[model samples]
Target chain A: MDLIRFPEMSRGELRALRQTVDGAFREFTRIWGDPLENLFAPLARLLTFLENLLIDSPWILVLAVLAAGIWLASRSWKIALGSVLALLVVGYLGMWEDTMRTIAMVAVCTLVAVVLGIPVGILMAQSNRMNAVVTPVLDMMQTMPSFVYLIPVVMIFGLGKVPGVIAVVIYAIPPVIRLTNLGIRHVAPDVLEAAEAFGSSKWQKLRDVQLPLALPTIMAGVNQTIMMSLAMVVVASMIGVRGLGQPVLQAINNQYFTMGVMNGLAIVAIAIIMDRTTQAYGRRLQKHAEAGK
Target chain B: MSAPQEQGQAHGIEIRNLYKIFGPDAARHLPAVKAGLGKEELHDRHDHVLGLCDISLSVPPGRITVVMGLSGSGKSTLIRHVNGLIAPTAGQVICGGQDVAAMSDVRLRAFRREKTAMVFQKFALLPHRTVLENARYGLDIRGLPAAEADGRARRWIERVGLKGYEGYYPRQLSGGMQQRVGLARALTNDAEILLMDEAFSALDPLIRVDMQSILLELQKELRKTIVFITHDLDEALRLGDKIAILRDGAMEQVGTGQEIVLRPANAYVADFVREVNRGRIIEAQTIATPAAPGAALPGFTVKARSKLDRVAQRMVEAGAGAAQVRDPQGQLLGVIDLPAILNAMVNSADAESEE
Candidate 1:
């Protein structure tokens, strides 16, 4: 019996396997490089444009927009003022442009994640087979090292803000999909029955009944997706995605604790601001749904 | 109230030879089940739960047919089958000449949209929608334009007594009020058939009674063919033109409240009626004697349709030993004596306790 022992395979077969894989990657790049780059170039350009716009825009206008958004979401002038003060403190630490850049990237990544994830989640909710198929894939995406996705992302999009956005999307999409599926599933069966009894078609039920009821849960999922996107920022910075993450990376490399702490605090500020806004928005939607009734 | 006439062309519902065995492969046990396997026997031998068996009944048009049973007696399953929500293992549900169980998806959708409306026990109003929106749901589903649907919904909202609360969402309403919205939604659909599955079972006792009266009041004017499911015998007696009593998925008895109360078809039915107050359900005509030949009628006359309890109340108030029972047109039909009413109320209690 010619069983290949692990140690023996490590000496010769491992090297062979590495060569085969490396050759496959090279051949794949050779064949698919132009088409793939062409597909991603527009997206890359959009990301670059957004990041630069945020970084170069006048800081006062950006802060005003941010504060206004916070105020709208929270329905509280106090929260808006507090967020503005916190953001101004970050600016005083000389990280205003970087903070805006980070916010822009997080925004794009979250948008892409929501756009792609919600449909997938609805599909999963509609069919148990789809859920069974996607659940393990989601588990892998969530639990596997976020850095591991960057390897293939770098190979495909080739080291830029696009690759960073792609990485963030991959990291952030699972929660929305899982939660959206859960939200749809958890809608009371009696309500669905009432809809069916009233002769709601499949599409009508989804639009008028299921999705509306599921909105709060889906919003919670969006909140988690945003948080996850922010968590990916420093890792995304590694592939030349410029943002506040860049300085934190530099601080780590140069062992400069103060720079790391200051940049880290800015990221935290952004995260807190985003989290509270999303949560407040979700609560408002719930209140609006129940308002007057 | 009337004899079981031919249900043909009347837009009534007839469920024939219905049998529902719940299992992964209920079809496989059909032969064994039809050959006289009992519910527990099926469970122990085939690991299958029997949901309904030989549930043959006819729901008269413009009247309520109450299917009464305890929780697992398959009353819910029976009501759901009317709308094709649950398919029976074997049966035919002929509603408006369409075999509901045999309907294809497209035809079934049409049947549901055009022919029927349902009220739920949970008052399943869409929480996200306002009272007006929820009420308009059925019309909206039928593809009516929003303006038309809204107009129809508003009429029903007022009819069901939620006129001022049109913009209110379900969460802001109390339980009884939510059920009013549910009733409004069903009524606004204007379907010929209304299926209510324990529609008032979730309400508080006082609210349940209030809702029941509201339904009775609406039913007088609308006269839709309503199939109402309930576990409460009193509710069945109050609402059902004909009540079908079920036990372990089999029909134990099918009759009017008077018929079932006076002459139970079997032990299961007798047990069910044992706790019922006879005076509340037995109509004046049921216990009325023939009028004294060529004699003057009593001073007070009770309507033939009036229950014995109400008749007793009127008789006691009028200080009469016997009251003439009159048809709706005021012609004397018979006379109900006070002793007969007392005997009915007391003897039944004594008979039940003696058992």
Candidate 2:
């Protein structure tokens, strides 16, 4: 080793490796560009359409709608009042429009992720081979740094709200899938055997027994997905996706501490509202299941 | 609707050369297993746990066939194979003249729906469904109309003595009541073959006795081909029309309860019957003296099927020295004296001690 001394070659080798990786990716993109665009365009259109619908609504009406949703989910007037108060504070702090945009992004991202993730998770639960394949991918998705996703997302979809939402969906999807798989797999073996003995078809067993029992756990996953969606959407603002994150990003660039603090609080307040509502709803569902028995 | 006719009921379930080996590549070791390799040896040599071994059993219709064994004796596996829940490595499960193991997917599904029902040890009532809904499950799966299914379910619920609890959830009921719902659900299916895998093992002693009696009473009219599995020898004796004893995945012996208790075939069967109350299990036919063709018949009579314990009580109460044993048709088949009944009640313990 002393004789070889490596010739101080590490930097050159690393540069060459980076160049090779970049060339390979470029070639992949050149070959797969059309199919990839076709695949993502519909998703991008759907997300943008939802974003417009939410952000275009009047502030007062939107606030009322959110407060009512919170009330329905939590079944507590006190929680509803707190949510309303938080919304008003965000408005007073001049972050109302930005907060709405962020909420819209999170809602759509979470919805899309759940719709796609649950069935895949069910498939995973039904087959050990599928589960074996999906588990490592899920581990990577959950553990990888959020910043790592933006490069691929922006490179494919280009910068904007669509790319932002795509990033958020990628970041938030694993929890729902993992939890749904776990919930179905964790259903009592006796219950499943009973279903089998009763001549339940595979679909019937899944729908009648597995899904109903797994609902609370899946709802918990939805809550986690929503929370992760919110976080990812804020970070997504770095690539020109406007929301509360935009103001915070601006504040960071220019050292405007007040703007940063206000926007940050707005995001936190939104997180708290969603967390309490979803958790309360999950508890109510569990109680309802118990009472049903 | 007319009552379920005796003809339409399944004749018998015939399990022939049944072998179950659990683990990947289970079939690869079937030859070695059937050739006489032990369960432990199979596991060591081929990494397959033998679940059943050459189990040949005939479960007669219109009777309760109780398969008795301790845990890991493969009784559960054997029962599951009857309903095609578990496939055998090498065997034929002939149910209703159709090979259950050989049925196609669609046919197996239909077989399960139209011909069989099961009562679980855990009383596997759906937690979210009310008692009535749980009872209605089999009918619902059969695609019966809601109104008609509800009526059938309600009747079974009432029959099982869970009348007022139809609207209550499974969690709202006691264990006994929940099992009643399980029974009601199984009955509502009206399937000819009822597979009860340790159906009453979870109940308290008193409740277990009650459920056993209920099952026996209903079975008198239902005449379903019921296969009951249990670890308790007492339960098997009490409920089984014929009992099959299993040990370490192999069938040790199979016969009437009286035959098993009176003359155990092997050490394993003997150990199982060692603590059994022989008086209750030994039928009057086993100890009855032949009635003379022209001799004067006794005034008092006992049923040929009566257990020794019951006939002994009757003889004591009536103060009869001897009683004619009448068959179900009331024909005098034989005579059972008080001493014979007494001997059957007391001699079992002596016989065991001598062994």
Candidate 3:
């Protein structure tokens, strides 16, 4: 090792380095702020109960999930059959219980994200300054890589299910905001002009014309939000979220070929199931708008 | 430009030197704008488009004034000033006695809610609401109880022949039907001044005629002051009590149908009238005089308001020496023979036949 010595830093230089270090540390703390009643304890409890409960009744959970996939595939017996077979295979190889736990987590996480995310997306779409300010922060949240987000979230919320959910939301919310802004901004000018001519006030125009017209695209955003939440499931396992991903990771480590394959199939099934259901809902909304027009 | 004087007439609207220029560069160019410049003169001087230039016209109570122009002729901009949807860059839009251009936002809202309603070209019924609900939206915004608004909306819907379709969404309706809903939405408010910006322009031609008939029936009953804008000359001739021909943001002429067709103020007005079927537009009451008992009269019953060309056609059709013209009360006033029709056409053509 070449041991190199430099002249000791002046006091101001030392202070400047301290300030930079302090600023970065402060940012780290802010990024993962307060998550117990807000974050960790309840989430872990919910995750543990779901994980344990699914272990108690894997077959029921698996069949219940196939129902949505069937409904969404919409009379496609082949796709429905294929989806059900996937769930059965996951069950046969003994990862079915863990898969259900992951499903429950995703369902809970997506619901929470939409409720919170939509209003924020609406707000972001509504104001230019807010969109300008929020968009970069969202970009940072998404682009920071999956592992970097977990450390602070895990540190503050401290190792459990709540950290996992929060981490997923942070990762997934950007698409919802981006697409929502784009959708509302893209409503036809002629349509909006008609609303104004009708003497609809600002609020009425937004509620009646803007929102209804922008709905199809917003639903597309919602679908993307849900897909992103699912992507977070596998990454969430490192923070001790004991879902299907844990079994997949364990089987990979242990070289249990049959086990990894079954768990992987279950993950694929969950993604396909969620994707189809949300897409169906989006189509229904599109039809509703067209019918209204 | 004429400074406005109080009209002893009881009109619902009186515009005085109302100007709408594009923006900041307008004031700098004002010195160069004449009272009314030719189209090319305007294009060269403004370096900006003139929308409604120093327009001063009126919409009389119980009458329809159709402001006729081509697409960029500022017909829509002129109507917006009447309802206070937009303020003029110069001059006043007087409704009853209040100046719409000077009304505060709250007052303008109150005025729009109470005294004026507008129909748009695209039939902008709310997609989220059913026909009845969309029609009631204006009333609902003014804080009327739902029951009251819906009751009134139902009546208007029935009036517009949309009774059975009240529950349908706008998308469920056909284009003509959707336009009826837009019409019903405006009519439900029962505002005195109805501003229709190409109200039936989006409908099919046959459907548009039906809508015009419907509007005529409504006007007979309600007697509202109506200011309608259209690029179509025939629609104007059919519906207008007074039609103002606009060319490049200036009024070419403002007069009744016969006044424009028989005696257009300028060539711009003449070209618009030339293509219109004068026989269909000019009424028997317009051109008829007290019947001359001893004249060699044509055997056709023609109206005094009948255009000279039409009376001539009737004369040709009848193969008579002259045609008898009548007024609204069935009084035969004057004889229009073939020579009279040909002479009138030739002499009027001499004045307006453009190079």
Candidate 4:
């Protein structure tokens, strides 16, 4: 017994295990990569279309639309004006195209995450077994190094916007999924019983009662997903995603301090705008629960 | 409004030999439970909590049958059985000649939609939905068209005195108003069987009385077969045409308010009725002496259905020693003296036993 030096796998054995796993994954990717890339072609098109729509639109038009959207979602003229001013500064700083690209990528990533996450969350909430199985998977996804998964993703999709989107979504989706499950599970039992007592089928109960009541919490989850996706922008740029993150990556490599800070500030501005708008929207949804207090 | 003839054909619920054991392997413990295993012993030995033991009740059509018990006495569990919200470990809940426990998933959903509505103690209105929307929830679940559901919901909202608060959310309203919305929601379903699980228990005492009056007033017209659960003896007396008392997951007694109050089935039931006002529950006819045929009845006559307290007041007002108790048809049934009323009012069953 080698108690002092903990027993471990032999170096040769470890090397053999690594090579075997790598070889198997390489073979798997060769066999399945084209089909997987084809399946995501439409998503790539959607992302490219959105990116062009944002970047190619007249600068003032983009600014006004974003301002209007912020106003509508947040119902706050202050937030809308602040966001518009921040975007103007970013534009004046000559980072307009990069900021737009980042916004588009984050938006798509958040949408995909929400669209996929909520159903999985609802399933997890409905059954204890599903919850048990999915909770650990979510933990692993969140805790594992992001670069560890990127290798397989890169091998399959080759390096581009689709792989970047997949990477960001994997990194960002856990909050929405976790929060959606939590929100649905936290609905008052009596209210759920009332729904059943009124002959609400499972679908009816979910759509009418669970979804509406859980909306605020789910909105919070979406907010968190957007924030997480934005946080992953710099990391995603390493996989050839063109965004504000690219300049930051270049700045890091070339040691240009101002470029790094400026691009980093642009990401922060977008994060604040998204965060405020969604938080305000969630509060508005819960206005009924707060009224007459 | 349904015709009286059609209303007369409404279904009464019959819950028979229902047993609910809450645990995994609940069915395996049924033999031991059926062999007279007590609730505590079953819990200690088998790790199975007995929810209800051999509960059998007949809830008459167009009348309120209140199941009275403390929190853990399985009153809520018993009400849930009628709606098939909880499947019994054994036995049947028969409504309209069909066993609720035996219903298929689709059939049970249809049955609940078509035949039953429920009111909850916590006023479980959808906080997101406005009062009108909450009221219309049952109809919406039944897939009623939006316009019709809204119209019917509006009518019931007004009927429940929540007319102006249609757009108000549940949290914005007081407990009483929220419960009114709950009642409107249940009534708008147009369900024959209305299940109220401690519906008014969450309200203040005065508000509870007001809600009871509202229920009684509605029942007069709607005549829905209502199963109301309560731990408050006064509420049971006020609302129940037939009251079933439960203790420790077992039925202690089942009878009219007067029957339970005047002659309790056991010491446990006697102890329960001890604090109840006998004057309010006991009827003049129940404690009256048999009068000879063709005998001259007292000038002061009270209806046999008149509660003892009312009978005493009338006798006192008339300055008569006793009053003749008359049936609803105004035919004299018996004579009830003031002394007897006083005796019954002051003397509990335990006191009588001591005497």
Candidate 5:
């Protein structure tokens, strides 16, 4: 028996497809605007409160944290010495305790971003419906006035390190999510398909295929998040964050030029350390995935 | 052991009346499905597209079924169903006695974890993990301890001939090496069914052939039920036990390599067959019959099942007039000469003419 084949799509069908896509794009852009904007200060306060809770034993915590940071960031003794000196100067400037508090807040915020960001990125990569939903959400997160994000958190959590950390997380999370999604989507479809044929479950596929391939991008996100968190810290101190931001803000307010410059240097040092370490980790992941191939 | 494995052996994937329409109106327009009158119909008139239209087929145990078509053919969508990567709008994918379409999230997860493996054209190894770790990832997702997963991953890495470079990431590897790792990753999962979506199309010609042979070697022993998707007629001929041609989300034809080549049911199927090197595709075991001539004082002979391509090549290269054929035990079976080949060629043409 003979079988029949369909002809190329008719012109009318192409027009319909174009319309559907155009309509979707329009809705997407429309949804990208801020759904909320007046919640920055309350969010900043909430970050401060959160910071206070995690900073119970400032000196010891600072020492351990600094050492670990050195171990992870730049293992060279000179860099470690520099890191230590940077901290001692902050202390001498009467910002010792505050430095520790900010460090704690930054650390907690980084952890939160990593934890929340990866799964969502994987979900976006795996589902068309989910991605369609998330694309607008991501667009809004990235495009909304950075300060506007803080308002809701400030209102809910109230001023302090808690609100400050919240603000940092909000700013820092988008890159991580965006990069992670890109990496997963770019993973060799063949490799993931191979994994599927091997009977990998969704999580298995993500952990095995998607997450591993995406680690570099996710790591890039981490680096971005860290830099962003540091950037936001200065902004956060305007509310009540005690660490470097507070001193910098106070220095600016009081016209203490030397103090402002010195505090800014400290934040810069922290940012450099976090950025370098995460970048190194990302490179390592890229190398690892290549090895699989 | 025999009882458990026998009970566990799957009949492989069976897809039935699958429909994946892109627009929201797909379900609503269900009763109006017609060839050339689907998404393209809506799309041409209203800019809508129906991605899939009632795709159905069964991949039997230990068989390689190639889904062939150009882009927009819905071949990829059909493969996706076998592994439950995309749920059909309306249909069932039965595998290992389970209706994949009806599976709950947890069941789907379990199915993916244990039953299916896939390979893509773009060798998707995890960038962060070392080759060993990437291989272990499948095991890891199933809750295997890191140490145990690593142990098996190491073995697969070696199997794919990537022994010393366990620590390198996906980016550091060459295209071919990455694909090897892809193979190793799937091997590690040891899933009974393997789905490939143009997995080698991205590779260079030489590397693609090498990979094909490697796949052959792996499948010879593993005997996994494999459903491979590709537009390349040569690839389909080389790898498939059966081939299903899809055009616009509908099956054009499904048959064994010989069946499709010798008797294409439609013009679309014939179009693909005409492009293949027939001598390379049909085998001695397939068309060779006992002729009176190959009785070379009687014992020595090529297996009747020897691939015709191999036999034909030996004939051309050695300038031999005829080739002897044998059976399963290598017993002298028959002689096949130029006439047999010419006969096969004519039959193929007749099939195409019928189409």
Candidate 6:
């Protein structure tokens, strides 16, 4: 029976182990919780400020800004107009403020992911040991169920925007880091050898040769991170993140089909806008690669 | 020969008993290699590839030294040692009396920055940077002010025949043009040593010849200590003031092109020189017979430095059976007959072995 079914820890032993781990984690949070929260206070403030700015602005002005940004990124009036129409549709459906909050959350989470992820990626690219260590950690981050980690995060930050932001960032950051490392590593070796022969120091090589060459790949990573952040918004709403996700969560609990479909379509609209704008931007960044060929 | 000293003091590079073994346990196998474990045997026995072995050569300043070999012959590895791009397993690279291998990382960087510039086979220009920006990359690394670097870079860009393409990126340029940019970038550094690792091997033959001419023209003015690597015997003959031959990670012979052609050090070199156009390589003086004192000089005269083919053409034009080989001062060095010139031109290893 033990061979067929898997042997397990006795109930008392399992309970004792769980109690010890839970107690230790609780103690750790009690000691470190306030300082860590304070450390993230500025991030929380930035998130709040961006959300407020988006929600409080005249809808027309925000629409105009988004249209201009899309136009600049895509260099096509059609894409910009389509994105503007999609945002207008989301607004007309009465999901305007919730959509704005989701946008703010995704934007802030993507920005933080890029800021923290690129350096980590560069470090991994620079050393075999770092790559060996970080690669498995990234794999685990991507594979681990988000809800399992959410328990600890919610306990520490106590069900607010910061923990939600942290959870989204945790879900989103791996792609950027992995792709940045890949991009930098994929830079032509002969080019790197040339830089070295010309006496470029480590930092100079990274900045001038590796980073610029890796920009297109890094942008792709950024796009993936943004998409992942949006995907995590609903999961994040379960921990008190207020967004279009909240209505979807409510509709799920109450079995309200129209409300769920409307909110889901709104999320899809934003994803398409972001995906097209960023993909276009990434393509533009690699114009030199296509110019002569 | 002891005339007045020239303007710039010659800073020749000398490689002394250098050996490079590739693998984690390279240092452990150095003694066995020094004692002459063959390259194949060492690789088979110890799993260590010999990159270079017991290489000793003097690269004279103000002249091009071409290291010639086919693929896997260690020609590329040999040039990398000069710039400290690859550390030697044993021995020293002495340039301007400074040991390159002994320098600290900081000092090596300073040395490479101040004294060396390298051109690669692939024309490794940064794809993202413009022609002008790429040209000034070395100066930028040295932290030169932007204006000065731009001025110098612009001068070189024009010098290398890339005048109006300042804003164009590398991908926009043709392969030959990209190599031109590579050359301009290296020249812009104004470094003392120019290391070219098969710099034109990737170009079309016509373009390669064009680039070779440009390099020679530039070398006439620059007089930088150039270490050029190539597998092409023709390029080695054309550019090298002194030529070093490598075979299976060891020095085969090092001399003037004519010396190698006339007197190959071993069978491998003899085989390599077998297909060479001997008339173009063997100079008139090298094959000339010593003239007797007060003997009547031949009616046709050719410079001692002129290749036998030119001497032959001139002799044919002058309708003479023989020609006098003279130095620049017009002093007769030797006499060469038409028959001897033809004989030397078609001479091959098999013929010599038969003799």
Q: Which candidate achieves the best DockQ against the true structure? A: 4
Name the regions of candidate 5 deviating beyond 4 angstroms: A1-68, A85-293, B1-10, B34-39, B46-48, B284-302, B307-326, B329-335, B339-355
Q: Can you give the lDDT of residue A262 in candidate 2? A: 85
Q: List the residue pairs that clash in candidate 6.
A: none
Model 4 clashing residue pairs (backbone): none
Q: Give lDDT tens digits, candidate 2, residues B1-355.
A: 3434455756689999999999999878888887889999988888889999999999998899999999999999999997789988999999877899998878888888888999999999898788999999999988999999999999999999998888898888889999999999999999989999999999999999999999999999989999999999999988999999999999999998888988899877877777778888888987888888888988898898888888888888989889999899988678978777777777565666888
Model 3 chain B scores worst on lDDT over the 10 consecutive residues at B1-10
Poorest 10 consecutive residues by lDDT, candidate 4 chain B: B1-10
| lDDT, candidate 5, at A255 | 100
DockQ of each: 0.59, 0.54, 0.32, 0.78, 0.31, 0.72
Candidate lDDT values, in order? 0.89, 0.88, 0.77, 0.92, 0.74, 0.94
Q: Report the Cα lDDT for candidate 5.
A: 0.74
Model 6 accuracy (lDDT, Cα)? 0.94
Off by over 4 Å in 2: A3-17, A24-49, A288-293, B1-7, B291-298, B348-355
The predicted structure with the larger lDDT, 2 or 6, is: 6
TM-score, chain B, each candidate = 0.94, 0.93, 0.83, 0.95, 0.88, 0.95
What lDDT does candidate 2 reach at residue B108?
85
Q: Per-residue lDDT tens digits of candidate 3, residues A144-191?
A: 998987876666667777878888888887777777778888887766
Worst 10 residues of 2 chain B by lDDT: B1-10
Give the per-residue lDDT digits (tens) of candidate 3, residues B182-221: 8898888877788899999989999999999999988887
TM-scores for every candidate against the unseen true structure: 0.94, 0.92, 0.81, 0.96, 0.71, 0.96
Clashing pairs in 2: A293-B169, A293-B170, A293-B171
